[model samples]
Target: MAWVVAGVVCVLYFAGTARPGYLLVRDFVTVPDPVLGAAALGRDGAAPRAVPLDAITAVLDPVVPAALQQRLLLVGSVLLLGAGVGMLVRSRGWPAVVTATVVATWNPYVVERLLLGQAPTLLGVAALPWLVIACRPGPYRSQLARALLAALPAALTPFGSVLAVATLALVTTATSGARRAAAVALPSLILCVPWVVPALAGAPTRSAAQGADAFAARQDSGLGLVGSVLTWGGIWAPGAHLSSRAEVVPMLAALALVLVVAASAILAVRGGGRRAAALVLAWSVPPVLVLALATPVGLSVMEVLQQVPGLALFRDTHRLLGVSVVGGAVLAGLLVARTTRSLSPPAVTAAVALIVSVVVTTVPDGPRRLHAAYTPVAFPSEWADAVSSVPAESRHVLVLPWQAIRPPLPGGRVPFLDPVPRALEPPTVTSRDLVVRRADGPVLVPEGEPEIRLDDPTQARRALDSRQIDVVWWWGVPESEPPPGFVTVHDGSQITVWRRGGDPRSQLPRGILRPSTD
Candidate 1:
């Protein structure tokens, strides 16, 4: 039943995928065929942000279109959240399970992350409840395998890996013994090796201290920053939030809903849920503290913490809040079950209505968000021919305009990362720098990943001068004059491919290579 509810939510949430063209928003760029190269292996003088995900997509490219693959994964993630939460509190009864499913699936955190084009990170968030259930006090022989299976998707990104491993270690140790916990944690550690190896081997990408201040949680309503974070709605990106969150009535009602949920949490803890409550409390403290300290009042605290090695991973801090969310869902299920058993029919209906109203208020325009965030982008048909025309031996294709994020193109309504790198056959060099527009002004965030910025013609010539780039694919508006002494191979309306003299050896490390096909 919970699975059925989840399926409906996914259908409604991602209705935009059914529209024509690819869904290009922020970091969510999917190409039919991705070039597997040094960057895929985290050897391109930068951090392994995509890492194993790119490699996994390349391996599956022959079987499934990358765009469809992403859609399936995203839908599967929501299902995982619903079913996992339902299963965890199944003992509570059907009403509790269903209510928990709706609560967990339709919250501000999930919606905001979706709008931000971060389905990959949500995998780990979805997996947390399941990991808890799998690691519960048990003597089963297949515990290790079950635990690892649940953790696989979460292992795709570093942040996800952290959440998965932490859940495994804590839950297993608390319910079972430390020995069993260690047994499960070992393989979870092994699962993270794909990204861990590259991060350790590659030149370390320096994390900016200013990012702590920049990405701090913002106050979304009259409820303020703490209230906004408590409701799991305050993402730093204004565009990512639902506009309804700005209203007073909805926020107050949302606050009432939070108080009721808090009461439920207390009831659950007092009634034999102490172990689960303890785990949730432990997980909540760090994220809440970090998020609070990232604000203006605690800027000094953040500055001190920012100097700590590897602290860059938690600069956003809000990502870790999923633990509390999952825990809260479990508690909420207990609340529903208890109410159903003791309260009158009228009371139960009112309770259910409260949950539904809060969700509706949180994302008042669900379909609109879907349409806006997943706006279809039609790449020129000539892109295929232009990229194929590049010499097979060419090392890097330097894409021009040198910027990362782009405003709405001819057929698109949302901003997106340049898709040339993923769409083209050869490995491409494009900007990783992100320009985030804030209320004050636009701030150019230099790529934390250690990639060379071809921000100007001088930089482009330098890359060409070094004889590292054999092809220059200029797409969209021309940012500057094309590098000198290069012959134009394909000059179509949308893309123009340029080839320089001589085949230069690739200075960047190489990964697995696949044959190019239409």
Candidate 2:
């Protein structure tokens, strides 16, 4: 029956991945830099400075095809998950049950990543539990084997390293024996050494700054806790726009069952299963604690605690769903093991039905809507017809703030600039860079707000003219048009293009227009 359940889950996951509706369009369109970093590595060896470079140079390089890479990643995650489940089933009945519970309630971010092609995180998450299981007290040889298996996933990515360390610490406390603890801890520590060099070299500082800013934003905004819980726990509120209440009821019910299981685990700990109870507590508590600490003052800590850690990672908090799922699976397995000792067919059937109900209700709606809201906006698809209408080799073309274009003429290698300047700040750099690098030519300043502010238009114009910018793609007619001698060439759908005549550098501020040799 457990095998059947696992099989069903795998099938559903695969089906979900294949569905067109399941592809998260918005996330793909608004690819964050970290995600881009991974994608760039997967596609090409080097990181790209701009979207055009990424799309043309990185994506088109000799790296593995996108579809193939995605499939491999998906398969790898499932396999790791299955290995964890297998270890749980093979362990003592209580431990098996606890492990299963943790896996079943996996983070929604895992699913989102599957939908978005961010496979490294998924692989890492799936591997953490297996590592824990392998590190449990056992023969020295077996412990070493488990430790190795556990380290494999953690070693693959930076995010995985953090999760792996946290899981290792919990598992060490949960299991008995010095050797087992050392076996697990040592390998993880060793595997994490590489990250230290990068961290010391400056990665951590940048990461910390980005994380702090993101944390501040989350604190100010109420921390998106409710949304994270719904997305991961598969529950939906009555008035929430993303999902139907009916669709969410089952998940809420599953969550209730999980709570019941958690209670049982607590009771079991009191009776004798101290290790199992502690493991469950560790799995559930730290994420919540981290979130609380990150929250800004004023919101009651008590109120914040109730909200969950969904806000910390935004849509990615769906990752916490994994912890809950694993907890539930463990609890279910424990119950089955305990009840089967004396139960008859009818009672067993009833028990199974109850567990199934819990599982069904807890599983969130698949990643379709989540994906739609966040996928990258494809330039070729969104603006192809409009771009096609323009004559090839035309040096200048106006593009809307929302419109996207591919670089080069009819797809040549000419340097293209977005008419409107893109927002180049962190937390979502790829999408911004993509917009900037796909212009028809260098002078095509983007048609909207420049991410950087200059003291005056004279400075802005001077900076542009200095860069040899010959054309301005204004999305909407600016409150004040570009200074005299710039001719408007095209205008439509919130976009206008202007050709420059006299150099504006002379009118610009020396501080702003003078290129720094540095």
Against the true structure, what is each candidate's TM-score? Answer: 0.89, 0.56
Off by over 4 Å in 1: 272-274, 279-287, 296-314, 344-350, 424-427, 449-453, 477-481, 502-518
Instruction: For candidate 2, write residues 1-518 as lDDT tens digits.
Output: 33444455555556434532111221122211112232232221111112221232224334653334434555567556655654565554433443353345333434444443445556766776676676667676777666766766555555566567667756765675555566566666766544443333321112111222222212101114533442343211111122322354744553465566666566567777666666566446534644544455423432343222212122233344455445545555665666555777677667656655555444355434433332222232323223333333233322323223322222222222332222111111111212211113211222112223232456455545554344545434454555455655555544455555654542321332211110
lDDT of 2 at 233: 30
Residue range 55-163, candidate 1, lDDT tens digits: 7887788888787787877788788888888888788777788778877787778888878777888888998888877776656567877888888888888788878
Model 2: runs farther than 4 Å from truth?
1-4, 16-64, 91-119, 137-145, 173-187, 193-248, 294-321, 367-518
Q: Whole-model lDDT for model 2 versus the true structure?
A: 0.42
Best by TM-score: 1
Give residue 397's error in model 1 in angstroms: 2.4
